[model samples]
Target: MTMLILFELPQVMMMMMRMGMLMMMTTTMMMRRMLLLLLLLLLSLLLLIMSQ
Candidate 1:
């Protein structure tokens, strides 16, 4: 019904927005961690190559 939808729409929209923000935050954090890990690995590889 229109009344039920009207009442529920704002709450549903808020929930979706919150979820989207959380997902974006988590993915960005994961990406940063992955980049750091890759950088560390690359540095270690360079060090190993230089040591030889």
Candidate 2:
């Protein structure tokens, strides 16, 4: 029973770590996309100003 518990502990920890990593990666990707969109908007505004 002790050995089974020990074996299961690492698997559970690894699974948790993997889940955390996936969440972090997806959040970072979403932030990057948002930043890109903001940059595009700023550039368009700048162009509009220059044209005027």
Candidate 3:
């Protein structure tokens, strides 16, 4: 009912915020990993170019 929803609204909002934060943390972690991989690839490419 409307009343129940209104009472639970704050709890729902808190849950949403928590989920959003978790998602952002995971996204940042992925971004860091991707960046490291890219850096390594670039370094390898540079080394190959230098060797040749």
Candidate 4:
């Protein structure tokens, strides 16, 4: 029982780490997309102002 518990502990920690990494990656990707969209909006606004 003790050995089984010890073996499972590392697996659980590894699973948690993987989950955390996935969440971080997903958030980073979303932020990058948002930044890109904001940049595009700014560029369009600048173009409009320049045209006027």
Give the Cα-based TM-score of candidate 1 against the true structure.
0.93
Candidate 1 lDDT over 5-51, as tens digits, reads 99999999999999999999999999999999999999999999999
- Better candidate by lDDT, 1 or 2: 1
Weakest 10 consecutive residues of candidate 1 by summed lDDT:
1-10
lDDT of 2 by residue, 6-44 (tens): 999999999999999999999999999999999999999
Q: Which residue pairs show collisions in model 2?
A: none
In candidate 1, list every pair of residues with a backbone clash.
none
- Judged by whole-model lDDT over C-alpha atoms, candidate 1 comes out at 1.00
Best model per TM-score:
1
TM-score of each: 0.93, 0.86, 0.89, 0.90
- Candidate 3, residues 1-52, lDDT tens digits: the string is 9999999999999999999999999999999999999999999999999999
- Candidate 1, position 34, lDDT: 100
RMSD of each: 0.7, 1.2, 1.1, 1.0
Of 1 and 2, the candidate ranking higher by TM-score: 1
Candidate 4 C-alpha error for residue 4, in Å? 2.7
* Segments of candidate 3 deviating more than 4 angstroms: none
Q: What is the alpha-carbon lDDT for the whole of candidate 2?
A: 0.99
